[model samples]
Target: MKMLAAVVVLFLAAGLSDSVILTKCGLKQQLQTSLTLPPNTTNVLAQIVCHVQLTSNFNTSAIKTINETEKPHESQGPRRGRSAKNVRPTKVTPKPHLESGEDKNEFWTLYGLFQLSDHVVCNSTQRHSLNLCGLTCNKLLDNDISDDLACVQVLINKMTAVIPDPETAKHIHKMISLIYQPECANAKASVYFADCPQP
Candidate 1:
């Protein structure tokens, strides 16, 4: 009986330590700097920030669900609480911590995804385009657009909708091509140390 109790305790400890907890969540501000992004772009970039955060949330939730399911029910006695009748589980994943530096993947990595420093020229030319892209992307994402190509379309279609003044429209039109080019299309999303791109 003592041996069995020790084994059970060890199992509980392991599960407790293994929970899918996140350590920190904000890396958005760092990338928002003008050196990497324009000041006015914050609103549009906010959309991107929301996008990555949603992805992280989904990850945490899915992990929680899966972890909960995989764990065997807690041991129960006839007198245990009502929950004891079901398979009560100890948390298997650690909760996420919100501090940035502590967990690169849980915080800093996702922060990088919102960093749009790579193409300043393309970005500048596409400010309206990008902002419009962000709006449309949020809309489509609300409706569901997981792949890269679909997101690119969101930008293009939104740009087409409200034709801006000639000069700005001309710039937006230029951005349309730039966005779909392989490099931009293949832009990476930094997901807490993992690549959150579609296969």
Candidate 2:
């Protein structure tokens, strides 16, 4: 009985230290991700959960809305064909296209970008999380002013052959820069509820 109590106390301590402000969906997502762990480990880890609050202006509803409505451009490029004169089957398979359809939801896309930014911030030359986000946003800027949709669209476009023009990239860069600027204090917000794992 004493040993069980100690384990409970330890778990409570860990949970308290890593406490975060997460939405209902965010907590659900984390539980789902945790379930993926091996059964043996899952049992041991199930008693403890950690949440970190990050700076982000996004919400679950916004993510869901965008993902369900947006679609990536389809590839209209020509396909390779083997003529009778060259009758061998082509060994090379075409590259997998990045599909942007109604299914491309914002939750996963934002999640992935934040996850990547986190990794880059921790492991790469970019030591600051805001800098890492800026680096990505800079590439998407198209004009003097930037909008959230423009940045998101550029990111989506990057998955395919359609590259954003310089003007567009500038606009996005400016927008992202504004968000990350010190006055806005929004850079950290990007990290908010960023790692919620869902079923």
| Leading candidate by lDDT | 1
User: For residues 9-121, what per-residue lDDT tens digits would candidate 1 score against the true structure?
Assistant: 99998765422323223333333332233344434333443433323321222212111111111111132333211222233343454454664442111101221111211
Error of 1 at 107 (Å): 28
Residue-level lDDT tens digits of model 2 in 1-199: 9999999999998765422233434443544443333333432121111111122211211110012122110111222342211222122222332455734432112221111221121123322233323444322222221232333333333433333676444433432332232222322222332453433
- Top TM-score: which candidate number? 2
Distance from true position, residue 75, model 1, in Å? 37
Residue 154, candidate 2: C-alpha displacement in angstroms = 19
Off by over 4 Å in 2: 1-6, 15-99, 103-199
Where's the lowest-lDDT run of ten residues in candidate 2? 57-66
The C-alpha TM-scores of every prediction are: 0.21, 0.22
